[model samples]
Target: MAEQPTRAWYATLRHLWLDERDARRAVPPALAERLRERVAASERRHSGQLRICVEGGLPPSYLWRHLRWRVPMPKLVHQRALMLFSRLHVWDTEHNNGVLIYLLLAERRIELVADRAVARRVDAQAWSALVRDLGEALHHGRFEQGLLQAVDGVTELLAPHFRPADDGPRPNELPDEPVLR
Candidate 1:
């Protein structure tokens, strides 16, 4: 597993900020200043760490069949997947003899940290489903979908309680279209 920063997320944030700035540029001087101030305030409030964890696993009966499917399967597999599918830098480390993926998109200040042991216990189908759902949610700017996916990926035995943080503006509250330049 590789952990890396997400470039798309940063691009999205920068694009949004630029759009807002452009929109305010056309307003009256006083109003433009107010708008800029409001945008700055909102940006300050929204900027923070967003952490997401997903559990992964294969059925116990399939353990033997998936012996080679363990986290950090092979360097080639990691490189190939990261090269083709990943948009961020992925860092890997050992924990409890299992792999842990730590990805930080510092520009967006978003971190995705997950334990491989949790992933190893869950079936691939279920894990894939969670990832797909979460990915779609993220692409559509729906953080709640990401949260739900994370909650659902956990096993009953190791499920952790997560209280949603009231950090920034919800997706719905953000403008659907970027403020035109």
Candidate 2:
């Protein structure tokens, strides 16, 4: 396990406020809708479900409690993503082929969580590259481009394992809209 970094209170405040103040500029409503549509289209190609979420930062509750900040950023992001993965019912797919692409704009970090079916087929290294590439685009202020590119990547990766049904279309197990925090 990695050691948790304890950041100063001021550092935490800066990250929370600075990122929240500019979330609209980072991923405006128009771009968010576009990304949502991209996911919808991508899901049609594969039975697996794909969802994208962008959060401004850790909740204010964490800031209120000092010890929570002692938790590492990666760990916080992973924990929140996992919670949303279940809360949003990403694991409800018939084939366990659900994926969530979570971005913590405050930390400039990307986290991808997939259900069991996806884990069985895709390599962790491949997912790491996809996340790295998406994070790069975000760092460069290419929010829509980065998200769309990742959606395409997820579509390609799962299309082989969960092909479209021949008799009838597969249901949209999850919503395509981006969950903004």
lDDT per prediction?
Answer: 0.32, 0.81
The alpha-carbon lDDT assigned to residue 80 of candidate 2 equals 79
Model 1 residue runs over 4 Å out of place are 1-116, 155-181
CA RMSD of all predictions: 16.8, 3.3
- What is the alpha-carbon lDDT of model 1 when measured against the actual structure? 0.32
TM-score of each: 0.28, 0.87
Residue 122, model 2: Cα distance from true site in angstroms:
0.5
Per residue, candidate 2 scores C-alpha lDDT tens digits across 1-181 of 2333335465477566855446666778898889888988888787889988777777766544535536655677688789889988998888898999988777777899999989999999989999999988978877788889999999989998888788787667788888877
Best by lDDT: 2
lDDT of 1 by residue, 1-181 (tens): 2221233334334433443233333233564344334433332332211222221221233232223333322332233333322322222212211111211111111222333443454455655565566556656756444533433343221233222236745332222111211
Backbone clash total for model 2 is: 0
Pairing residues by index, what is the TM-score of model 2?
A: 0.87
